[model samples]
Target: MYVSARERKLLERLLADDRDITVGELAEELNVSARTVHRDLQGLESVFRRYGLKLAKRAGVGIRLVGEEENKQALAAELFRLSHHEYTPEERQLMILIALLEANEPVKLVTLAHDLNVTVATVSLDLDKLEQTVEAYGLSLIRKRGYGVELAGSESAKRRLMSDLLFRHVDEHEFLALMKETIQKRADAPLDTVAEKLLGLVDRKKLAIIEQQIEQVKEKLPFTMADSSYIAFVVHLALAMERIKRGEAIHFDPRDLQALQATKEYEIAHELAESLEKVFDVDIPNEEVGYMTMHLMGAKWRNRQGTMMEEPSLTVGMKAQQLIRSVSDKLGVDLSTDRTLYEDLVVHLKPALYRLEHGMGVANPLLDQIKQDYAELFAIVADGARQLFGDIPIPDEEIGYLVLHFAAALMREKKGWRVLVICSSGLGTAKILAMRLKKEIPDIVSLEQASAFEWKGKDVSAYDLVISTVPLPEEYGPHIVVSPMLTEEEARKIREHLERKTSAAKRMEKEPTARRNKPIIDTMKAVRRISETIVHILDGFSLEVVKRRSVHEILTDACRRLERSGVIVDADVVVEELRRRESLGGLGVPGTTLALYHARSFAVLRPSLTMYRLDSPQTVAGMDGEPMEINTVVLLLGPADADEEVLSVLSHVSTLLVKDEQSAATLAYGGEDEVYSLISGHLEQFFDDYWISMKE
Candidate 1:
């Protein structure tokens, strides 16, 4: 929320240039150290990433924002609107005319006249206005006498003209309204020009009727002003009327009679009927009954005589009752004949009826209350209890019923649910893991696959659960780790975990102290630890050994280890980024070499050594298209943030490896001790660079 002034300036620069910038250049421009520039880039990248943007870097090319075209357009649009007051309406109109002309061929005066429905003389006058406006904006407006006007000017002039004419004149609300109208008009139109297309969707007949209704209402009420809200109310009522005619439930809000006491009686009735239809699925025809109800309420609100303390009676005659009964029968709901039952039903129906009559709100609150009070009666009348069930089951059952119930409850409580599936490798085994987990979890809205390390670094708070096959990072989410075989015991344990979590969540709601509170990540870590402990007991494999293997090797091993481990499974997990990185550069490094190894069960890493040593070391391209040398090699094991973390470390390592001085110093120390220290120091720097690139 609080962007630094420097970041703000950087954003402006990007917006203006529409290109990526290098850290070196930014440092020079900002008159800051390269380190500071790198930090700033990281901060910026973090902010943008939260908004679904990616900051990409090429080893020597610098940083650029990937997938932010739409964001830039939106920002440009906002800037234009803020500067709109500088242009007059006439100038704006002329500018649009010029743009249209420039887009078309031949510059036909007749076509222009026809487009605006104006005479040729008027078109000429508009062209003159356009020329004057263009000149003021530092642009040249050329008239070909025979051809139409064309803008021939500097790019800056063109940009200024476009910014003022297109972006500046349209505010968000106006834009939304225009877009809605355009889309309504041309439903089949491409999405590029939504606002324009919507205008074409409006039905002429419906629009005329709406206008007529509005006029009539104005005469009766006499106090309502014609504002955008009122216009929207009228449009929605018109649309709702059409929907109701087609037996559709109206979804629009109705005008408030109390707020629009000055509107005419007929308009009030129309608005109220629309509101009622939307709220209660009742289609009341335009009848005297509706008019009378509106008259009563309109009169009360107009006189300011109705108190909040007073409850208005909404009793209808036997004829109206019979009509209601007919509707209920049509809807397949039984209607009680007893006077008291009928009276109570009428009480529930009154608000809707009143709204139908007076352009008042017909919200379902009163009906909901009535249903709660006489649920049994209403249930039978509304139709068999089956109506309540539909596709959803009753709340208390186990299996599918409980799942649906939990899903709905969670949706209501959290607004929605997101999930992440953590698994090793990017190919066969990870996919199988995801598929198996998906079968067990029904409420997952989104599922992303990555290794434990990648999942831990990324934000996981949005996910409800993390189901993994291998030991994950020290922290992740509510985890359910299963073996490759996915035995019956594993299934049972998973179910138990879900049940326990569900029960605990319910208990927490009822009694706050029922369970100790812990951060979600901590809980996930505990779950992982527990799952791993059980796995080790069953399989006799140390979790630490599992963790030490690279993601590539983990996947490769999962496939091969399956035959011996009695885990009959096909682990064909292919690390896409690994291959992609190889395509970009190559994963080989000097002295120590990293190669992607594959087997039957899962993908794994196999680090090997080349016996030959180089006398004069030279740079070789690594997985990031960067130069590297033979001293050290880091094989990116799997698709765990391969593009980000792995590639970043490789880039930094390449930088050090390619340096003759650093390599000589490293070689002098010789053993693993010297190599480890050199690599570790560089790793820290690499991490810093990685963070910086991310921010950028």
Candidate 2:
């Protein structure tokens, strides 16, 4: 059967593992679509059958390669021989563009198709994508009907495309190692051939000369240089020498060249040009020197000998702080104090801002990986970048690097899950179940016990695992159902569920970012799950669309309605407590247009939620000490002596709103019945994470 390299790797990975793997994970590993992987799996089934292996799948458990260990090994060996690897469309497009650039003459589309082993239509599609990729580097794919195609652009733009495409498919370290191996006569590895494919012909002799010249230039510089800068400088200079030897020249913007000539790096570039002229016997143009200066400006600085090698300009530093603060405000987390995050971002921005200014493309091989693994973090950073960079459009590659700093900081956070125990009998029964689980389950960080009465009265969405003693009408598996006595079978089942639910690490497998995020995702999943399941908590809840113009009237009306429904006895008592709480600080969640008015009240016999959608948003003092609008009011009232567990869940709900008004807005803006589902579904994982903190 026909199989791509990615499919081969997927099969090998599946065979080597004893458990199931998700299609999403395989797609990520192969850098393809999930649908693509699904297609590959279908093709793989017949091939696997050849070696007596079968693909077995179950819902939520993912897909597993089921067979004897010997059969798996045999299948792996067979796949190794049969996997005539096909490049992904992205890889093919990049190679095609490079091949086009290398071709001195217009080549036939059929020839290009044959090279890619694809049809003319596929080649055309690939070229369509290639056009955009090249255009970003200021080069155009010029197609001549009945003739062929050529890349039309300035020598400088073509050179930029060359350098970018060189790094796009491979890592910098790998490319460097390839050159070094060639220099040392150790170029026998398969990777050497792959490097050649990526870089075309490197002319190792020219690279060696530029490597020495760059070393000399580095020693003469005042600032500590980054390795990436040094390596890129060598390649750029080598290629420049090659182009000059061919009597070709590159041009830069006159203003940019004029500005570059004033820098120390350009002074060094001039001296280096003189040395290159002597070695390569070609006069290096001043514009090329400006090009080198541009490249130098984009080099990221590195620490040297335990000292900070460089601080970005004062403006860059201020921009960095502003970005960090913006992200902190968005996530509602104190990211500014993350010293490592701040320092690394400052380092990245020094070069990043310069790259943006110079319109240079920085190829980040990990960009796709970062996008998938740290999606939430990436969104926050990307959103913040817009305000700082304006509509300049920071490349996903640059954004990926920026995300790394925050991702690293988030990785430093403690990882685990929280527990919530629900018992229908009473507090004592709840305690029995909670204590047994706590004693047996070390993963239960903090345990809260509540009777079914209290659980229904409050939002129990803040806990990770909700263990119930009596039969729950709700089917919340991963919501362990066990005896209060902690029977051996029940314990085993709980342990198994906890492992599957909490340790997302096993499924993450190989990527560094995924490995780092396993615990974080696990924690979040727990909270999200609780939020999802808490739809029941909103059962018998009151909803209304109030046209009242006064916040006081809105509060009184909600309390009066809850009292009329017999959910709370004294409308006056609930209203007074809510008013008193509001007097301390506005209950309005800034930016959400939703106000949470909640209080522990003597007049409340049970926990109840009343939501009133205002006809229009009203101005109120924001929790952030600014004037903000509020349109949705959520009134929560609990008995004054409500169980601590009930209070805990209610408090978590408040905290959830305070930390992220956007999340609250998501819950508030949905349809009346849907609000309960949205709120419950979103908070499931938060409860899990709450348990984790308790463990701490």
Misplaced by over 4 Å in model 1 are 1-94, 97-103, 109-143, 150-169, 172-580, 585-602, 605-616, 622-631, 639-671, 674-696
Q: Each prediction's TM-score against the native? A: 0.25, 0.51
Off by over 4 Å in 2: 1-20, 24-59, 63-88, 113-125, 171-173, 182-195, 222-227, 304-312, 335-340, 410-696
RMSD each, Å: 33.3, 21.2
lDDT of 1 at 35: 92
Q: Model 1, range 1-696, lDDT digits (tens) per residue?
A: 445546655554555443447878777766678898778777877657555656678887666665666776565454433322222234335534444423523456676566545577776777776777667656666667777655665433443344334323332244333323432453444422222223222333455455554555454552222122243344444444544454433221244323333333455666655655554455665442233334334221111111110112211222224433443465454432222223322232333344334323221212333344334444433342234223433211111111221122222211222445554322223434443444555544444555432455655443455577554435444577665334444666766665665645643442232122334465455444333322322233211113344334543554445434533322344334334434433444322232222111133232111112233343455433345553222322222222222222332333333233445345333555555456556555544433332222
**Residue-by-residue lDDT tens digits, candidate 2, 1-696:** 666667766776786555567888888878889999998888887778788878889988688887776887677656544524376666677668767766767878888888777898898888888888777777888787888778888888877777776665454435555445433453332321233555543555577777777667776664454545555667777677777776668877798788688676789888888888888888888888888888877776553121121112323544666788898898888886454455456666876788887787677654565677669988989989977789477878788777766654554523344566765332223444554565567555555555443356534345445677544445344366665445555777777766764356522332343334245676566554444324434675656787855888988877777778787888898888777666555555554677677777788877666688878878886654578887788776666775434544554444434334355666567667677665565456545555655335
**Lowest-sum lDDT 10-residue window in model 1:** 302-311
The per-model lDDT (C-alpha) reads: 0.40, 0.64
TM-score of predicted structure 1:
0.25
